[model samples]
Target: MDSGVELKKFGLPSQCCECGPQKSPALCSAIFATSICPNCFGMSVTPGTRYHTLLNTNEPPDESELTFVRSVASTVDASLEYLDHEIANLPENVKRLEEKRASLLSYRVRNNAILSPLRRIPPELLREIFSWTMPSLEGTAEVALCIEQTPWMLTQISRRWRVVTFSTPSLWSQIFIDYRHSHINRDPSTYSPSLMKAQLDCAQKLKIHFYGSQGIDLRPQIDMFKLLSQHSSRWEELSVELTAEMVPILMTLRDRIPSLRRLWIQWSTVEDQTGVHSIDCFQTASSLVDVGIFNDYRFVPVLLPVHQLTRYDMDCQLEEHIRILKQTPNIIEARIDIAFDEEVGSDSLETVDLLGLRRLYISPAGVLKYFKVPALEELALDIYGEDILSLVRSLLDRSSCSL
Candidate 1:
């Protein structure tokens, strides 16, 4: 036979069982064996296996492919076993380590807490820290919890922080319970007393603010004042803004709080013109060295009995205050509120009759005409709605003639 005809007669066709005469077969398998055609066998196992076990023909494995496959299989097996062991032990190990870290932190905090450092510092230095932490006047808003909000920064650092916060009386002092801007409206009855007592115990100065709450009847003020009266000796300063009707309850506190030094009793800015009659609360602040009374022209004369006051401010009929200046002997500083006129007159000069007065502030329309001012040191005059040059000229003339 011819050479080509004899080769075709002996050769096997390239088709496989997996290919099934449709597509190229990378592999074909049975229970006993897996076979790949020479064209596709590279896709299945390596050439090394082909020579050793797969093929009855004479082709052999490429040595490089055999070495790569053996190394890959060993690595894959080792990785799987190692991953299993790591997954099995991870959670328990994490829990144990977390517990140990928590214990260590707790020990560190307790050992290094604020109390020890606080105790070691001198009392004067401690007082300065107390002063530094004290809250400034927060206008009409509710007092924000500056230290309480920053508990983590100071308190969580060590055991000493907690001790210092609790032990330092000055730190806890000056609790401002401003019911005006608080959520106190939701349950006023239940909440007011508790806050009052807590603040009273912790603070030496108390500021009870009542902002924009018409619903807060006088009963709450009375109750809180009663509670504060119980701790009167510690109450050093008080700033109260209440309805004109709450004056009675506040006056009850005057005798009880022997330690009270400063008292500010004023009406609401919004509720300025509500009541026809004015009530006086200043007479009760006997220990008061500073007082501010806000009233209409018709209401200021009744409070002149508080003559022992060091500082006094009144928004009332300025002419009516002449009687007050005539009576109160030790008036150090006085601010009298009244409309002024340009004309220099005897009545206007008589208004500042506090002979021992050191500081005097008069309003825009007030005319200081004639007076015997012996100890008058600082005088402030507000001259509005008038000819500025003429007013100054008349003042200079009067000042020269008086001298």
Candidate 2:
């Protein structure tokens, strides 16, 4: 609107005029430094300000000038329409995504400001948070513990985040009882039973692995067993990897735990026990439903006494093993690892009479011997020579056995 700045003409087409129609000769200079219609100065142009500089310099109307207003109007209308559709169709999705983003940012801020200063937090809260995010039955206990110890970024940023982290019970639930996955040596005495007891006090399932250097202490093993016995009422699953010294404790647990539905035991060393002393420990646990056992010796068949057991797994290769396993009346599935015996005459042993067995695994040796087993969905063998393969073929010839 300054007087010194003469409004020049931007000689555009009549259709591009600011006003509907013009009467005077178009000077074709911009009124200001805008793409303005020259006939009626800038007043007759569209609502947007236009430059006069281009027309004064003999330049044609820019493509930007031609379409800017219309395109802007179209974009605005389209945006409003899109907003309306999105509000109706995907409101929750948009809201959740935005909230997640906000949560991430808030956590970052908190980590930078608060939790870094106060290193330790209440055990309960730490355990709870860990329970929410820690890998469930997937990761090793060490890795899960390390992840739980990872500092909350938001807590590092401010006091409020630290307070929230400290107060939340979910944070503490992350502390789980890891008996099987955590590294355990011969000295069960060295284990922190109190800490484990506190964390897994309410746990429904527990997996414990036990190994030894030369031998294990009987007393500590008994103490550990006592701890398990105390909490056995709530236990739903139990997996125990045992050494020879832990037999007494293992045997005692059958009577103590009434709620156990699943049990897995792998006995590495039996301390050269014959059937005389071993049979005393065999007690039929009625509640036992699923059982997997890895026995080193063929003479001991402790788990076979559980007649009510429905599922059984034995990773052993004894020829007469199935005879013991046949004691389980209701067993619908049995996975037995059997070793081959070449010296034993193929005709001496009777055919397997597992009337209820739907699954069986026989070593290549067992396949070689003239054998009749019940209909099995799966069978595997360790083949040493062509004789074994021939035996397998001969056995499968009776039925089409696919690997």
Candidate 3:
């Protein structure tokens, strides 16, 4: 007997209805008995075989194939039940794997945090790093109080940062605030008077840069000023823009401010340009080194111990500048914004030689003709009028300045 035709002894069909030419067929589920297994096919499951042809078509079989067809169906149904049980477990298996993956990710993050260099740094060094984030109040930008500012923001980052920020005095030393918030109807959240008080309390010595509206005065502003004035002895640097009404309040600082080194004051009024309100509060600032007074119209006047000043800035007439410059013989740097040139003959005027002056700035051309600064190294001139170069050259030649 031929080996390929051996399965025919079981009287099985030779052709499958799946492919008409009876290509290589399979009986993947052929056996159904005590053990339902495909291997019980008794021959290889291939094309042109009895079980392959019947199972592929699943059509009504001839009477001779009826028994074999029912056997294949029972075996397929059992295999489907096994697959149904496995499919039902898929969701739980996926959920368990996902939870395991999340746990590993969390563990990795915590491990990395433990190894971070910042955790191992000294607290003093870490606090110094935080202090570098403090803002430099250069013009009027810091005049408005905002909780979002860097110094205030540092306190909110974490418990460690908040503790470090509170201990660093330089972070709180610069207190800049405009007492004119009520004019704009600003939100209370935009600034905090109590926070300013807390800042003053935090720093040992303070640099107070205060500003306010030109005309309007509020009780809160007065109270804040008074509160700051109480610490006059601790003021290292003071800059303010004041009106006539604030003059008496500043007079309270007389015989009070001793640590004051740098002072700048601006008159905050346009209505009373001719009215000069003088306060001798800063005359007691014996340690005062640098003074800046913008004498636009002299509405608010101040007195400083000018003899000891190294740097002086004033917007004044030529005679007034010479008068003040004579007093400040120690002045090394001076910015004179000439209000108007005096008509005095050059021969009548004594050539004022600023012996130690190294840096000089002046405007409107004629002030240089009066100054003989032998030590002048840098000269900034806002030149006007004809023969300005000749005027500068005359200043350099007679003074023998290196500028």
Best by lDDT: 3
In candidate 3, position 323 carries an lDDT of 75
Please give the lDDT score for candidate 1: 0.53
Model 3, C-alpha of 309: deviation from truth (Å): 0.6
Better of 1 and 2 by lDDT: 1
Q: Name the lDDT value of residue 118 in candidate 2.
A: 40
Error of 1 at 84 (Å): 12
Show model 3 residue runs off by greater than 4 Å: 1-107, 139-143, 180-184, 215-217, 272-275, 299-301, 340-347
Model 2 Cα shift for residue 344 (angstroms) = 4.3
Between candidates 1 and 2, the TM-score winner = 1
Residue 240 error, candidate 1, Å: 2.2
Q: Kindly list the per-residue Cα lDDT of model 1 for residues 184-243, writing each as its tens digit.
A: 656455434664455456554544433324555556755665565567566667666655
Question: Which is the winner by lDDT between candidate 1 and candidate 3?
Answer: 3
